[model samples]
Target: MNTDARSHVHALIDRLPPVQLAALETILQSMLDPLSRKLALAPIDDEPFTEEDRQAVAEADEWLKDNQPVPLENVLADFGLGMTDWETMAKTPLPEETGKRNG
Candidate 1:
């Protein structure tokens, strides 16, 4: 809890113009998200494209041309989970793991 640092950061934010402020907000919001931060920092894939990779990319491109994108909720629903289940799953212990300790 560095109040002085926070105040200084806020003061700097206050001095930014509308466009720079918007960009700063986007950058800050992205850094706060663990997945987004990892994705932003991750290096580009440099591996040579194999036949499988080429086929997969062609299939994906064809599918995109003909079909709509699948929603995250629908994908999760296929696994008997929902968008809101992530928090609960993280907090709850697995039944097999619990049994192993209790047995």
Candidate 2:
């Protein structure tokens, strides 16, 4: 690592506005986190949108308009699960989250 370059980055970060920090955070995450890097580099889906896709969206909207909203917990309870179950299946923290950004 270049100590001078790192000092320059720290200086630039210290000078950045709060609103601009989110963009910087995203850039840094994409650089250090493998998942973020992969996603950032992933090819865009360019398939043409069809009438069937529109119809399906319309049907979903109509269903939402006609039905009462169900809470996530109620739906999960039907399958003998809860939010804690989701937590157990959650992905491990990103390198940045674990302070392992050098990767």
Candidate 3:
């Protein structure tokens, strides 16, 4: 941002009461949430998949086509978690848990 715009934001923040500041934080997070979710779901890179990766994905797709897909709730239950636990993790995943790829 330009210096003047940043200065204006700083001034506004300085004048906000704690409660108002908290509200502003919530508003800001709401604004950012959609973009953050999109980024999280986006592919990491534009590179073509390796042959092994392609084969693995193809196998997974074929398996899913033939077998009944497991519900997310069932999968979570296998790990002793439920919908609430998954939702909580989704909202605020740990840094180490973010952007991980499984083989």
Indicate which candidate wins on lDDT.
3
Q: Candidate 3 clash total?
A: 0
Error of 1 at 18 (Å): 10
Q: Please report how far candidate 1 places residue 13 from its true position, in Å.
A: 4.1
How well does each candidate superpose onto the true structure, as a TM-score? 0.48, 0.53, 0.50
Worst 10 residues of 2 by lDDT: 86-95
Clashes per prediction? Answer: 0, 0, 0
Candidate 2 C-alpha error for residue 28, in Å: 4.8
Candidate 1's displacement at residue 54, Å, is: 2.9
lDDT of the structure predicted as candidate 2: 0.83
Give Cα distance to truth, residue 8, candidate 2, Å: 6.3
Displacement of the residue 72 alpha carbon in candidate 2, Å:
2.0
List runs of model 3 lying over 4 Å from the truth.
Answer: 1-43, 46-48, 93-103
**Predictions in order: lDDT:** 0.82, 0.83, 0.85
Candidate 3: what lDDT?
A: 0.85
User: What tens-digit string does per-residue lDDT give for candidate 1 at 7-71?
Assistant: 99999999999999999987897777655565666699999999999999999999999899999
Specify the highest-TM-score model's number.
Answer: 2
Which portions of model 2 miss their true places by more than 4 Å?
Answer: 1-10, 17-20, 28-43, 92-103
